[model samples]
Target: MSPQWFVVYCKSREESRAQRNLENQGVYSFFPKIHKERILRGKKKVVEEALFPSYLFVNISQKDEKFSAIRSTRGINSFVKFGMSIATIPDQQVKQLEQLCHVNNKLAINSDDAYKNGDKVEILSGPFKGITAIFDIEDGLERSMLLLKILNQDNNISFKNSALKKAES
Candidate 1:
């Protein structure tokens, strides 16, 4: 039988250590991490943290007794099991997870502080290109409201945050 993915529970804050031990034992494993932007000491920084705290994934063949020593591996508490059966992860799901994490691993939360109320901005690349507007409150993560002047009337337009840039000076 071929090796299949399984979840390994680790001691608190020991996911990286467990992954290292598994690698040293020539066992395949994955410890997915994500980059999070945070404010520390009044400064913004990006920190890499385990996507799944106290947990990592390993590939093992259930029928291979020779690999049974994994339970005694350092930093690993035990394998995640349901009732009397160990949970097995499908290769497709693992691959898909790998791809998904790879694409979105670096996430920016409250990272950009470029906008402020009444700041003059220009629509960089959109149907409103070259149009000047006032930056308003951020509507959400990807959306913001801009105050634009059209026909001598103040009009509010909602657009993506990426669509606006500080108007020269």
Candidate 2:
């Protein structure tokens, strides 16, 4: 029987562990990850985050005898299912996801559309409304870190990305 892609739901925050266990069982799996820029302790850092948290793809035949072993694998909750049928993914789609992950991993900390370091920005709404600050780095998907000058000291502050805009030159 030919192998097909199947989805495996993992225990909370245990996708990595599940992938490792599957590999040790000789099962091929794909756990997609994306690179993200974050600020930690006032320092910029790049981190890899699961693109699909708590889930990964495994290539196995439907009638494979390893099904029982896979079900008992550590950190694995179960194979995704719909009613009595197990969930499956198209090979093409998985290939596309792999390509996208490849490109994302190679991307720089900040993309061209993202704010650059030292770029002037204005707080749109918040306790710091209208305050001008220097762009620090992206804190996460929806937040950013900025350098705000307060009382002659530069303070690192985090704000919702929606609360900030490029300051007009």
Candidate 3:
């Protein structure tokens, strides 16, 4: 049978629990991750593994007997939806995720500071174009945020390295 990918509906904020439960059940799944510095109650900074927030992908046969097995698993709320059926994830998205997993090294997530704060760059994707913005680089250089200057406000926009081709000279 061909492999099918589907989005699993996890309990509100209980994605980790669902992932663990699925693994214990011997179900093949994937949860992509990235490193981000977060502030803890200790007022100290530390890197924590967050479950990319609330999403996970599963590979299984829809009409197989095990389909019922998954529906009964703990922490799995339901399959993702559209009308009255499970929402099938697009192949491109799955491919992108596959590429991410195939690579070795830390994945860059947020662009709190992906560029020089005062550096100038053109807007890549948005309503604004031919306009310059301050490229804000983060402490880790994992990502960069483009702070657009509009009127008197700085509109912050972030982009991963692949999303951005390069800052046009």
TM-score on alpha carbons, each prediction: 0.67, 0.66, 0.53
lDDT of 3: 0.65
Model 1 Cα RMSD, 1 decimal: 6.2
Candidate 1 per-residue lDDT, tens place, 1-169, comes to: 8999999889999888888888988889988877775657754457788888998889878787736878888899988999988888899988988887777763344435568889998898788899999997676556788999999999888989888788888
lDDT tens digits by residue: candidate 2, 1-169: 7999999999999999999999998899999999887777765577899999999999999788887788789999899999999999999999999999998788755556678989999999978999899999888668888999999999999999999889999
Rank order by lDDT, top first?
2, 1, 3
RMSD of each: 6.2, 5.9, 9.5
Clash total of candidate 1: 0
lDDT of every model, 2 decimals? 0.83, 0.90, 0.65
* Cα TM-score of candidate 1: 0.67
In candidate 3, how many Å is residue 25 off? 2.1
For candidate 3, the per-residue lDDT at 157 reads 72
Error of 3 at 3 (Å): 1.7
A best-first ranking of the candidates according to their TM-score comes to 1, 2, 3
Clashes of 2: 0
Give the alpha carbon lDDT tens digit for every residue of 4-64 in model 3.
8888876667777887888888787776655546646633243545445567788877876
Worst 10 residues of 3 by lDDT: 104-113
State the lDDT at 18 in candidate 2: 93
Q: Which regions of candidate 2 deviate over 4 angstroms?
A: 109-169
